[model samples]
Target: MGTTQLESVPEPKYWHLKTVLTEALDSEFSVGEILPNERDLAARFGVARATLRQALEQLELEGRLQRRRGVGTTVAPPRMGVSVGTEQHVWPGGPGDAWQSVDCTEAAPPAAVADILETGRDEPVHTVRRTRMSHGQPVAAELLYVPASSVPDLSAIDAPAGAAHARALLRELHRLELEGQDSAVELGSARADDAKELDRLPGAPVLVVTTRYVAGARTAALSVATYRADTCRLTFGDSGGVEIHHPHRHAS
Candidate 1:
């Protein structure tokens, strides 16, 4: 037989690497699986270390990979979907509610929060902190601020102070007939406290959802919720329509 050799295929330098890595994550890797170190992976792929790192970084931003300081990169799980809307609703606190009241405080609302409440910067407000757990995993931290003016008769409420007080304040708020609500979403990094609450390292990417509740021509309350970008998808409106996936790509 005559000796014959087939031509070698050139390895793609960029997008193709991403595709290959994504497919590997889906087919072969489980969530939280630590990937092979960059140098080893590069050698195995016959690509430069820089090229491999670039692909990894892209995956990290898209929430498919999580990189730790001492720990290496690992496969990330899919984000959970939480609804954000203006519709009058109550926390179900039932099987699928996924929210738990952690702690509460009475303090002056921050300048930004006060501005949203249409109150003075140093005005006293009830601050309620809640942690939202999806599938038994912490996914978000919420700071709810209710101005005193919104709940003038809180003294008669029987619940303990702080979170209980905040919950009472919410009940009073519901009495006014929620006229409407406005919400804004922006990209943010988790703060130290919020990061701890969400069980993520500081500076981790988050999606901030700011909401203002209105009742009878007055701004009632302000809620600032920080959701882990790697593990949550904030859904608004009815979810019956076409599925709009996350902005980033994920392994199928």
Candidate 2:
């Protein structure tokens, strides 16, 4: 794409520049290649530095580019296709699950989670942390909350704390018949904890997928998952179903 002065286009100059830069990225740049400096890019595109910066920011939000600390901006890889359909009724730590259990602890849940669990606001629950990976890269993080009532059979002898306790809690949860799962997807900024887990900056855009697992006429478990917005493509299933699919699954 040749650099053409954008003085008369009906659309905003920066929007037009974003289009041109996108074309150039597809045709001229490879994945992980660092882009030219802002000054050079502005000169090459015949746009003001501010306009070029706007275009670059937009591309980054759209998953076309990445700005890394000390690494500069680079071409981004293909967005991973993630399915958020709710058609199946299953436990969290079932066989073939993509998310790996990280740690488990007993702590008081947030008020909102407590409300969902129908427990006292200050009541402590079993909180399990998990993470998902693709191509050896962190793609999502999750916090699974299981109330004591949900995993009554979990014992210290059967499983200790940390990841072992997490697996045990999941196993105990499976004893109850899974009535249904409800999930909601929304765009949110990454909190400090989520950012560290996903290797992103605080306040970076993220896709929050909240799920409630129902059993025995109550919400037995709650899952709040944060997926990297820049790398995940969420597709809702028909009839308001929710499932998480990783298109780039590796063979075991």
Candidate 3:
């Protein structure tokens, strides 16, 4: 597309520029490709630097672009499809699971978790920390909480703290038959610790997935997973894949 001056229109100039830029991105840019500098883009679009910046910011928010720490703004790939439905119901560390164990500790879970697990508010549980990676980048962090009642046979001598302990806890958990699991997803902000692990600035948007595992008619364990909102698109059912088309872009 040539440098066509956008005529007066009802929509804001930045919004129109965003549309034009979207077309350019689709036609000319490749994934992970750095975009032209702001000054050059403004001149080419016949819009002010302020308008160009506003459009760029909106695109970033929409997951069309990413501003890396040392790299300039780059075109982002289609959002990764994350299966979060009952069809994939299994233990957190079960075979084929993508999350890697990071650490394990014994501590009282949050009040909400305690309530769901039917444990005393002051009761300490085995909390396992894990991270999920996609395309060589961290996409999600999870904390799995298991009460003593769930894994009563686990001996203290075999399991201690840290990553090894986390594996032991997961092994003990696998011994029980999982009756079922239910999940809920919500928008959330990254806490400081999660942000550091995720390589995102504090308060960045995230998708929080809370799941409760049922075994023997009781809640056996609870998991809270936080995924990068910009990089993930949640999928349900047993389809194994999803393709969603938008007029501006196609999301997978």
Best by lDDT: 3
CA displacement after TM-score superposition, residue 129 of candidate 3 (Å): 1.0
Cα RMSD (angstroms) for every candidate in the order listed: 8.6, 7.4, 6.9
> How many residue-pair clashes does candidate 2 contain?
7
TM-score for each model: 0.74, 0.82, 0.87
Task: For residue 17, give model 2's deviation from the true position in Å.
Answer: 1.4
Q: How much lDDT does candidate 1 score?
A: 0.75
Which should have the higher lDDT, number 2 or number 3?
A: 3
**Candidate 3 Cα outliers beyond 4 Å, as residue runs:** 1-9, 156-160, 245-252
Report every candidate's CA lDDT. 0.75, 0.85, 0.87
Off by over 4 Å in 1: 1-15, 32-40, 48-51, 67-73, 85-97, 161-169, 244-252
Candidate 2 per-residue lDDT over residues 1-252, each given as its tens digit? 789786874888999999998878877777778998999999998889999999999999888888878999988777766657647777899886899998999999999999999999889999999999865568899999999998877754467778888887888888899999988899999999999998899999999999999998899999999999998887666444344432322223
Best by TM-score: 3
Error of 1 at 164 (Å): 4.6
Query: Candidate 3 residues 111-141, lDDT tens each?
Result: 9999999999999998999999876678899
Question: Pairing residues by index, what is the TM-score of model 3?
Answer: 0.87
Cα error, candidate 2, residue 237 (Å): 2.9
